[model samples]
Structure formats: structure tokens, C-alpha cells
Target: MIDTTRLLSGHREGSTLPPLSLDVTKPGNWVVFGPELTAAAGPWGMSFSANLTPDETTGIGSWTEDVFIKTLRTGKHLGMDTGRSILPPMPWYEDLKAVFAYLHSLPPVKNQVPGPVPPDQVMKMLSTQ
Candidate 1:
């Protein structure tokens, strides 16, 4: 037997922050992370992971602290676009601050996961799972 409430709590909407999009880089590369996983997408043409690293050339170095907040606030690169929706199932609504807070606590690794699948696939992916 187990505590369903506690187990369920782990799955709560704001239980944690989503992936930070890292560069897959090479095969031998080891990404520093805890035991968790989620999906991320953007308009980059291919799948991409967030670059949490502080490296100015490769990671979020250029992103101001406000930019980090906007990632969740506007869900569109701090008003970078005017029409593109951030999509659902990812839950950008709810407590935007929670997500922002979680991401804020990360060490910024350069793991750049693939991003932004094709537009046509977006519908299929979102609709299916």
C-alpha cells in the first residue's frame, strides 16, 4: 500500500517546472539532472531542449531575468510573436510564477534538446498525446 495523496501530489499542475531545452550535443555527453522528464517545443523547425547553461554563447546567458519570467508569462518569448499560441497539454497557464521559480533555481546546463517540430505535426502531436 502507498499514500495516493502524496503520490498524486507529485503530479500536480505546479508540482515542478518543465524542461529547460538543452542541446543534445554529443552521445558521450552526460547531462546533469534530477529524475524527471517532460516535452518542449518552439518555432525552431526541429525538436529542441532549452539551454539552461549560463554560457553567453550557447545558453541562456543573453536572457535577462525578465526574459525568463516572460518565457512563462507570455508563453511566446516575451511578446516576440503576435499570433503564435504556446499550445496546451504543457499548461503555460495556472501558476506561471511556479514554473518561473523552478527554472530560476536550475544551474543552466548546455543540453539543447531538439525543438519546434513541423507545423503540420504540431496538430497531430498535440491532438494525440
Candidate 2:
């Protein structure tokens, strides 16, 4: 879970993260997420906005607060040995307990995010300079 206020503020201000073209000024768009990108595109691939809802089978329902903090602090998926490093556009260094608390407060939603795949050399060449 991310602190939407901070993340959106960064986006709005054009901070280090990639610029978000989405118009955040519109009412009710605060919940609006993104257009998912594939990892095969390269290190810069921007995956879809995660299903922050706590569905046990699909979302973060099973994750503990420690894992959440570890994920942000270390940028590793699952915040453990078995997962991959957290990808780009996620400012994993900034861990906000309020974000995790908010996530915990939400009703679980079963949204199965697509698994990321490794990029081939061709895609690597095409997407990156």
C-alpha cells in the first residue's frame, strides 16, 4: 500500500517518479489507477495499479505489517527471500504506516494482477536506450 496523498502529490508536482498523465484534479478520480505495462518492455515497465484491497486469495490480505514495511524498505516483493525486487514507479523507500493501515481497513477485493515476465533482449533493446 502507498500513501496516496504523498504519491499523488509527487505525481502532481512532477517529482522523480515518471510523470502521471492522469488528471488527478477531477473529483472521484482519486481512486483511479493505471494502464498496466509489461515487464518485457524493460526495467522501466510500469505495471498496473495494484489491487490494494485485501482479498485473501488475490490481494494483500495475508501480508503482515512487517512484510509490508520490508517490501517498502527493501523493494522486494513479499518483502522476503522468495520474491523479486519491487519494480519501478513504486517509491519503495517511503514506507507509510497510514497507507498500510488504510489498506488493512479496506474490504478484500479479489483482483488477480498479471504476473510479470522477464524481458527478452529484443524488448530490452526496443524499450530502453
Candidate 3:
């Protein structure tokens, strides 16, 4: 027997990981050729996951496909232009083929990624349990 209430409760708290600041997902919870998405959001440590949307401030809500391609392909957010590096588990160089292919196949929805994981806080995140 499925405990509907318990299941729902689990979702409320167990929906994401233990280290992000916000929850970033597209409508329908469907990611085309998605990148690295931890089960739960990380704690609001020194850094948080970018919304990964196209929004100006909160999301990647204003980028071009070409730019997006480079960001993931090189794992250098904005391709060295921004002079910042995306954190680990982004799978930019690792699983890019699928990420690119899937993203290309999905509808271009404007979502915003939250703030970034500051360099100072990056190491702490790695050591966090």
C-alpha cells in the first residue's frame, strides 16, 4: 500500500539535495538534455546554483544558443569572457554531447539561475557532507 500522505511529505522536504539556495526547474519538471541536477538543492552556502534560465538576474534568461553551447562545452561560464568557472558536477565537458543535443531539442524557455558559488565557498561545498 502506498502512503500517499507520507509520499507527499517526503516530497516537501526530500525533494532536493542538501546544499543549494533555491530550486531551479523548468515548467513540467522536464529537462530536455539536462545538465547536472542534484536531487535536492545545496545549502545556501557561499554559492548557490545558477537558475539556468534565461532571466536576466535570476536566470540564464537572456543568453543565446551559441553562448550557451560554449558555456557548457568549455565549462567556463560565458566562455572565458566572464572570467569565472562553473563548479563541478556541471558535466559541461563530461557529458556535453547529450546536453547539447537535448537542449537543442527542447523549447527555449527563459529561466534564471540564482547567484553563483563564490570561489571562497567552493571548497567548503566540496567538503560538506
Best by TM-score: 2
Better of 1 and 3 by TM-score: 3
Candidates sorted on lDDT, descending: 2, 3, 1
Positional deviation of residue 14's Cα in model 2 after best superposition, in angstroms: 30
* Residue 79 in candidate 2, Cα distance off native in Å: 0.3
Clash count list over all predictions? 22, 0, 28
Write the residue-wise lDDT of candidate 2 on 27-97 in tens digits: 44433233222111223444444444576765678889998778777888888977887765566766588
TM-score of each: 0.32, 0.39, 0.37
Error of 1 at 66 (Å): 1.1
Worst 10 residues of 3 by lDDT: 30-39
lDDT of 2 at 75: 87
lDDT of 1: 0.52
lDDT of each: 0.52, 0.56, 0.53
Give lDDT tens digits, candidate 3, residues 79-103.
6666577653455677867878988
